[model samples]
Target: MILDVILDALLDTAKLIPFLFLTYLVMEYLEHKTKNKSKQIMQKSGHFGPLIGGVAGAFPQCGFSAAAASLYSGGVISAGTLLAIFLSTSDEMLPIFISESVAAGTILRILGLKVVLGAVSGSAIDVLWRFGGKKRREREEHNHIHREHHEKDIHDLCESEHCHCENGSIIKSAFLHTLQITVFIFLISLVIGFCVELVGSDKIGYFISTKPVVGVFLAALVGLIPNCASSVVITQLYLTGILGAGQMMAGLLVGAGVGILVLCRTNKGVKENLGLIGILYGTGVFWGILIEMLGIVL
Candidate 1:
């Protein structure tokens, strides 16, 4: 059993390498091509970041969310954009639906709902962020100042991701970045997988009992397992007539693949990370309750 779990983790972690490498490669190219005023215009145009992220994230690939987290950590995208991708990402849901032979219309509805919600929610968060506290643009100013005179001791997420960004070859740097994050993800996934196995799947079901109100809340918690298993279980339960559409949506909304795990590992500030998680969980719970109240069938 342990060996099987280990192998599963290894294979799963391996899947992320190509995506990570590709994401880093794109970022490296942009880094080389864009600069100063060009960068500022890009950031300014990020008013639509959530929309872009939403569409991109709605695809079947889980790597998009991971890539978004890395981008947010590096200040390449706004937190709202990160939230949008994380919110829309369905992880294993797409494949499960296709394999289960679910109707194409039904699948599109689900995907469309996630995309719309993710885009709206992400934009809202960005608006709130701009008004509630310091704007991301203002913070970028600090990014330019030399380390010697900085007040905040925050480490650059780009540098923390890897020091290879300055290397001559973009491919080499991207590969190294991919390798580093892959190793980190493998170790983390291994530990998480072992713990999940130790706890047993039966316990997960028990926690999200059949009660509608209770299940809606607990399902979101279950959605946060940081592995593909959470999504598989949630989607299966929904199709089996165990979970309601609202409850399923709730779980799926929180099911951002390993995006949260990557965020926690890479992003600076414990409070900031926790805050993001809180927002994510709250979004899931809020929608779950609202959907249940409205009797909106998907």
Candidate 2:
């Protein structure tokens, strides 16, 4: 059983490695090549910022979440845009589903749902904040000061001999990141497979399938775990029939991988981080229930 689980993980990881490597390689190269242009676009996006962030976040990569966090901290993007990125980010779910031969139609539906949810929710939040007299741009001066210090720190760090960005090794960095994430997925999937074997899929399904509300909430909580492992577990559960589409959607919606973690680290305020978590979990559960009510099956 253990050997079978290991083999399953290896097979799945092998199928995804190439796509993962290529995606990250392209993203890294773009980040390096179009840094100024990207910043200009982000800065001038205005009301369309969240929409852009959502689309970018839906690209099946977790690295965008970290980049979004950085942009938010630098005040180059609004909180709504950052939230949109977090909501739409699926981490390893899309690529994993593709590699597992999930239907392309189903994948499209999932992506479409995430993108719409993210854009609408993010825009609404921004509007509400504006009405509540909490203007995002009002903090520009503070953020500018913060950005200056932040840039200085980066400059000092890059001046050190250990920095690789100055050496034009972004591809190497992307390759290493891909390998790291693949190993993480393999380990998590192996554990999940073993647990399913030991506990039986029916039992696991019963636990998550009992009460719809509880299942949705539990799934959202699982998504809050700050690693790709949560996404792997959710995907595996769904594939094994241990979770329905609604439950899986809830988990994926909240599973921004390390996005929330990065936000907490970069934003310098615990209250803001907590608020983002609440919004993410609430939105995910709401959508989960809505999907269930609509009788949409994956």
Per-residue lDDT over 1-298 for candidate 1, one digit per residue giving the tens place of the 0 to 100 score: 7897899889888888878888778766766666354357557978999999999999987888888887777667888899999989989999999999999999999999999999999999999976766555456567873333221111264466656457567787778777878888888888888988888767786677578988999999999888988898889888888889889999999889888877887787699899999999999888888888999887
- Candidate 2 residues lying further than 4 Å off, grouped into runs, are 1-43, 135-207
Worst 10 residues of 1 by lDDT: 146-155
Instruction: Judging by TM-score against the true structure, name the best candidate.
Output: 1
Deviation of model 2 at 233, angstroms:
1.2
Whole-model lDDT per candidate: 0.82, 0.71
